[model samples]
Target: MKELTPVTIRPPFARYAHGVEIPAHWRIVQTSGQLGIRADDSIPEDAYAQAVICFEALSEILKSAGMTANDVAHISAYVTARDHMAGYMRARDTFMAHATRVPSSTLLIVSGFTRPEFKVEVEVLAAAP
Candidate 1:
């Protein structure tokens, strides 16, 4: 006799996790939407800088869960400016340089975010071994 149970990833998702979980013994990390704001409360104001900052914050969250970018299984990115697409891509590639695996990703251009001053936001999902 087996019963089904759900897992609780977390709130304000620090990666990209849903509240529900499945029956499995796997480690997961969910991060909240990350913006380009620096530790000092200064935003990059540019796509490239924003992208880098967002990914760096994601990395930090992953690390807290004993994981790395390699463990990432999916990523969702939002850019405020389409003109900065190339710059954002460059920054993303550079940041994931050491990623264990390149996970599936989606990039979207949006009119704006909660913070009008932000240029980019990123959310990631990681499954650990």
Candidate 2:
């Protein structure tokens, strides 16, 4: 994947690329949005913890498809409120910490999720040869 950050436009505000380009021949893996719920059905009260769970689940999904976080091309994330943005970003940063290049990212503020306690949800598109 190629990180697209043209010098003509303003740079990304956070730890991500403005866009990403993947070869047409490369295999791609997309993950559905992951919530914070644990296998035991327990939800953490803090947004950070919740976001961590979301990212972890997404990471595992990528692994299942023979890809890793470094193969990610884009990320889409949602938070229940604006207050959760920081926590969600922190988790995203951690998730891409080892990536060779950061993927393009989009974050949104949503009214809520299926469960009121779900503070964040995340999804990703990844590619590999």
Q: Quote each prediction's TM-score.
A: 0.77, 0.97
lDDT of 1 by residue, 1-129 (tens): 021123552343222233222226668777898999999999866788888888889889998999887777677888877787777778777767786445556789999988788888889877765
lDDT winner: 2
Report the lDDT tens digits of candidate 2 across residue range 8-57.
99999999989999998999888889999998999999999999999889
- For every model shown, the clashing-pair count is 11, 0
Model 2 segments more than 4 A misplaced = none
Give the Å shift of residue 61 in candidate 1: 0.5
Give the Cα error of residue 70 in candidate 2, in Å: 0.3
Alpha-carbon RMSD, each predicted model: 8.9, 0.7
Question: How many clashes in candidate 2?
Answer: 0
Instruction: Judging by TM-score against the true structure, name the best candidate.
Output: 2
Candidate lDDT scores, in order, read: 0.73, 0.92
Scored against the true structure, residue 79 in model 2 reaches a CA lDDT of: 94
